[model samples]
Target chain A: MRHDVILRVIAKLLIPFILLFALYVQFHGDFGPGGGFQAGVILAAAVIFYGLIYGLADARKLVPEAVVESMMAIGVLIYGGVGVAGLLLGGNYLDYFVLDPNPVHGQHRGIFWVEVGVAVTVSGVMLKIFYMFADRGRVDE
Target chain B: MAVTVLVIARSRNLFGVIVLGGLYSFLMATVLVAMDAVDVAMTEASVGAGISTVLLLGALYLCKSEETRPVQAPWLPLVVSLAVGAVLAYGTLGLPEFSDPKAPIHTHVVPRYLTELKQEVDVPNVVTAVLASYRGYDTLGETTVVFTAGAGVIALLRRRRKDRKP
Candidate 1:
């Protein structure tokens, strides 16, 4: 794949747009069809595309195994932390109404953070799975 | 779609089977879009067709590319699958027609979601509002489930340094 000039060139051209689309899906989800899950998968797909064309070692360097592992946990923590924040604000668990003076603004704030958490965890899990499978194949060879 | 499934079932080449499975998922995603579930269609396209195909190919790389013929007729499994399919089809007959306005789903919480989403959540996408705000706990649980699944896979498949033979 590395030696395939056309593939390498096309991949370099496409990867940046794919990454941008993922970000758009993540942040614009509240106004559009996509959300965290779709955004996360799209983001992972971009990296996996890079891995497929540039070699797994290079992809791993771009997003290290340790960083990927922590992403999985950190996302859940962010989500949980938002809920705790809601509780500390004297609201019920997972309540969005009390996050701010304006209830609607609070809802927006809460949803945004929660979606971000979901995107992070989902992408991490996806990359970790990809790396594990690719690594096993390398070990076998 | 049925023809694709039949071909996938009959094909011995695992690579073709994996590709056909992705085709099936793409077709399913199209059907979801027709049903107006764009969000689910996106997920089915990416996760089902895109990621799963790559993962299956990776697994195939580590194993045989061709499936061995069964020693005997697989009659029991065939009958069980047919029975389950029949039962599912029968169950669908009891449900309302597609996009029925008076359907339970449309008449239930959907009305409230549609009417109040703009004022309450202030989000244009009702689905996002419902998923992230109205059903926040469920999403939290789902996130935990994804995390748990990743942990489980890492536990089962990851190799330790000392365990790797030189």
Candidate 2:
């Protein structure tokens, strides 16, 4: 793969667009057909594409294992924290109505954060699984 | 789609099987889209087709490329699968027609979601509104599940520096 010029060039051109599309799916989900789960998978797919073209080592360098691990936990925390925030605001658990003075605005805010949390964890888990599978049978440098 | 499955079933090469599996997923995604489940279609396309194929290939890299012949007769498993498929097909006979407006799904909670979505969540996509706001707890649970899966993989597959052979 490292020696394949055509694959390398094409991948280099495509990775950024793939990433951009993932972000589009993530943010535009509120209006369109995509959401955090789809966006997360697309994001991980971009990195995985990079890994396939370049190398696992390069992909690991791009998104470090520690960072991936932390992302997995941090996303869950973010989601749970939203619920806790709602509870603290004198609303039921996972309630979005009290997050802001305007209930509709609070709903938007809550959904946004929740989707972000979902995207983070999903991407992390996907990358982590890819890393684990690709790492197998490799010798230590 | 049926041809793809047949080819996959006949193929002994694991690589071809994985690629065909991706094809099946893509086809499934298309079917989902035809049924107007765009979000689910997107997910199926990305996860089932894209990532799962890559993961299967990665796993294949660590093992044999060709599948070995089964030691026992395949007839029993074949019978079981056919029976299950028949049962599933029979079950689908009881389902409402495609896009039936008066279907239970459309008449039940969907009406409320469709009517109140703008006022309640105010998102253009009802699916997103439902998943993130109306069923926030479920989404939270799903995120936690993903995290737990990642943790479990790390536990099983990660090799520490000290554990490596010198």
Candidate 3:
């Protein structure tokens, strides 16, 4: 795959843009059609493209399976934590209005954090699945 | 989409089936966009067309490119599927027309979601406002589902790697 110069070069060129687009989608989700789930998939797709062009071992170096595994848990924790925070703040579970002094800003803050959690969890899930499928039954060279 | 499905049903080549599956996803996205479900369309295009194709290709790498012919025609399963499809079609017959203001869904709290979008959520995108805030729990559940799916894949596949290793 590395010797495939065109693919490697093009992948080198495109991976960054794909990740940047993922970030844009993640943050701009509130204003547009994209969201955490879409952003996460795009991000994983970028990394998977890197794996396809370089190698699974190299891609693992960039995003170790350990980290990917943690991400799967961490994202859920973040979302759940936000809800717990809402409870601590004297609102009902997942009630965003208590997040900030200003009710509207509180809503924004709540949504932002949850969306980030979703993004992280989704990306971790995608990457984990991709790595699992890609790494299986490898015939060592 | 129907035609593509028919072709996919007829094709025994797993590779062609996967390619057509990707095409079907893209077409589904187009149909979603036409129905003004841009968010769903974006999701379908990215996940269905993009990630799913890559996944199927990886699966194909591990399996034969051609599907093995069954020992006998799966008549029982075929009959079950057709029956299920007919029941589903019948279920939809009583549903209200799309985007009809008089529909039960439209008559619900949608008015609040639309009217208070700017003031409540402060986001112009109603879908985002609704999903992230109003319906946050549902999205949380969806993320959990993705997480569980990944965990399941790891559990199933990683065992093979561990067994193979010295």
lDDT of each: 0.94, 0.91, 0.90
Q: TM-score of chain A for candidate 2?
A: 0.97
Query: Native contacts recovered, in order, as a fraction for each?
Result: 0.90, 0.91, 0.86
Off by over 4 Å in 3: A139-141, B73-80
Question: Per-residue lDDT tens digits of candidate 1, residues A1-100?
Answer: 8889999999999999999999999999998899999999999999999999999999999999999999999999999999999999999989988999
Question: Regarding TM-score, does 1 or 2 come out ahead?
Answer: 1
lDDT of 3 by residue, A1-141 (tens): 778999988998999999999999989998889888888888888998898899999999999999999999999999999999999999998999999999999999998999889989988998888888888736521
Candidate structures ordered by DockQ, highest first: 1, 2, 3
Runs of candidate 1 exceeding 4 Å displacement: none
Cα lDDT tens digits for candidate 2, A18-123: 9999999999999999988999899999999999889999999999989988988888888898999999999999999999999999999999999888999999
How do the predictions measure up, each by TM-score? 0.96, 0.95, 0.93
For model 3, what TM-score is found for chain B?
Answer: 0.90
lDDT of model number 1 = 0.94
- Between candidates 1 and 3, which one is better according to DockQ? 1
Distance (Å) between predicted and true CA of A2, model 3? 2.5
lDDT of 3 by residue, B41-86 (tens): 9889999998999999988888879877888888999999999999
* Candidate number of the best DockQ: 1
